[model samples]
Target chain A: MSVTLDQARKIIRQTMAKGEDMKLKPLSVVVLDAGGHVVAFERSDDASPGRFGIAHGKAYGAVMLGMAGTAQMKRAEDQAYFMAAVNGVFGGHVVPVPGGVLLRNAAGKVVGAVGVTGDSSDNDATAAMAGIEAAALVGEI
Target chain B: MSVTLDQARKIIRQTMAKGEDMKLKPLSVVVLDAGGHVVAFERSDDASPGRFGIAHGKAYGAVMLGMAGTAQMKRAEDQAYFMAAVNGVFGGHVVPVPGGVLLRNAAGKVVGAVGVTGDSSDNDATAAMAGIEAAALVGEI
Candidate 1:
């Protein structure tokens, strides 16, 4: 389904709830539509002030590459210059981290993505996955 | 209320819906928190790709100056050097135009700002006002 505001809010809610249930730190979450545009975002009360930017960067990176954040990170692993160039061109909107997960529709079409931050990379990924599942979408991260 | 993700999304939705209803050109919109950081943003399907940066710049300018984009433009009038200084210091993240509006909370505190770009500056300002109203926030523009 096309990413709607309701869907975006649902994903954010689910992700933050998962963080709470797992006793993870307060998190920042962001949802982006297929066009690499933000649909929704939230930085929890206890989340670091900088979490919002990092969350958006990760989600934007995932959407731009059409892959998981980790995959992008791996691709940029040996190319520091490439990563730097991306950041320079995009105004620091690329964060190749495990917190970003691509979302797919039932037909396996990439619909959008979710990005989470404020915890360990693995925990952020797990929170994002929980959000994708809660929205009844496939998580590819 | 604080500018939550839901509020930001609502503002964007209302702004774009107004654009559609008015038969205006596609627009790019951005929302920034009180600290002058992006909270959410969108580029309409038909919007020019470059509009994203411009929209963000306008919003950032409004938030940083605690005034409307037009006001900022007026303040910089006849002072090209000042405008250049601002651009240099902020890395060109300021667009003093009519599209940006400062959002205020119930207590009259600046909460965030919204920026729209696509049509004429006046039309952009109208769209931003629509969004702020829809979000139940004060609009200073």
Candidate 2:
């Protein structure tokens, strides 16, 4: 099954909590179901408006790749034209960064994804893992 | 203000219930806040992949119109060039159809819009109304 709204909210909440605990910058988080339709999204009060789109694009790209998002960076570097075309197909919602992670269910099946934005890409990825693990789901970080 | 994630999910849940009750086809639904930012979206397991974009477009069109979307159909017919240009401005995320309905609060303020896709436009409109009503909000259908 794809990510449910409740699960998506939990991921957002836990991501926010992790960001606070880590003293990261104000963050925006997005969770997309397996099919890449947004299930839920939230941005910390101080986050810039652009954070939302960035977070969403990261998750959308990761979900479409069916893999961790950091790998996208290497692809973008090695195959610039391919990455550019893929971004066009997704309306530019693909971010080649470390902030995107996959959400998997008990059977090790990717059911959705969590993307975070605000601080460094590494910090964002850490926050994403924190949230996914806290929600009792597997994180393919 | 704008629609909350909780309210958006409630609308989707109720919309799915209504569709199931009426035995309509598997559906995809979208909820966009007043600013036309997507807040929440969902689709049945078997829904076609294109449903997500269709639902999103319908909701985006209605939210931008800030009025009942059926009026959009008339405008599109009367001023085809303008409608086409407007759609281009929105990156082509506009569906001039009955399934798009604006959401209002108790004060009759436009807060958001909900769009549905799967069945016929009339049935989709019916489902949209059911969702808006169940959420205890007003539907500007």
Candidate 3:
């Protein structure tokens, strides 16, 4: 089954809470359904102005590529120009970053993604993974 | 008070439910914070391709102009060039349409906006207003 709206928003909120617990900077989090449509999103009160778009882009990229954001980053590292062109084709929804993770339901079927921004890439990934765990969803970070 | 992530998503989901109840087309809905930053967004599985951007534009226009989408449309009607320029300056975030409405909190202070797209303009406004009401927020349709 696909990720529900409540589940999506819960992932976002839980991820931001994890960031807070780690004393990390405020974060923006986004969740996208398998179809590449936004299901839920939030920006911490102190998050930077552009964090929402960045987080959403990262999530969109993960769902679009059917891989973790870090994996996409690795793929883009060798072909930045190609990746940029790809993003252009999708109206800049693709982000080669480390904070996006693929999410799966209990049955291990990919369902959606969670993206976090505003901390170090490693920390962002950690938070996103934590959110997935909190939701009892499998995650590829 | 600001619109919480839960409230934002609830607004979107309820608006889509309203659309379904009315036998309207599939819809896309968006919610923006007082600062015009997106808080939540959703697109029905069968919604039109560009409905997401259109929905977001409508909400952004309502929040940025401090008026309902219909009012903005009226103002823009007499100054098409000016409206176009405004949208250009904002990177096309403004939409002078009838589907956006301002949301006010308990204190009657404008807190954010909700926008809906899919059916005719009047139907869109009706759906958006219903969502705001469901969220217990005041709305100007």
The sequence of per-residue lDDT tens digits that candidate 3 reaches over residues B18-121 is 99999999888888889888877777766654666798888898888888888888889988898899888889889898998898998989899988889998
lDDT of 1: 0.83
Clashes of each: 0, 0, 0
Real contacts recovered, all predictions: 0.20, 0.20, 0.41
DockQ pick, better of 1 and 2: 1
Question: Could you give me the TM-score of model 1 versus the true structure?
Answer: 0.77
lDDT for residue A23 in candidate 3, whole number 0-100:
94
The DockQ-based order of candidates, best leading, equals: 3, 1, 2
Q: For all the models shown, what interface RMSD does each have?
A: 4.0, 4.1, 3.0
Candidates sorted by lDDT, best first:
3, 2, 1
Q: Give the distance in Å from residue A33's predicted Cα in candidate 2 to where it truly belongs.
A: 5.5
List the candidate 1 regions with Cα displacement exceeding 4 Å: A1-10, A20-24, A32-40, A63-67, A72-93, A104-112, A134-137, B1-10, B42-51
* DockQ (0 to 1) for model 2: 0.22
Rank the models by TM-score, top first.
Answer: 3, 2, 1
Worst 10 residues of 1 chain B by lDDT: B43-52
lDDT of 1 by residue, A24-137 (tens): 998988888888776667777656668867887888888887878888888788787887897888888899889988989889988888889999988999988888888888
- What is the TM-score of each candidate's chain B when compared with the real chain B? 0.95, 0.95, 0.94
Q: Write model 1 residue lDDT over B42-127, tens digit each, in one string.
A: 66755654676788888888888777887888878978788879888888889988898889988999988898999998898898
lDDT of 3 at A127: 92
Which ten-residue region of model 3 chain B has the weakest summed lDDT? B43-52
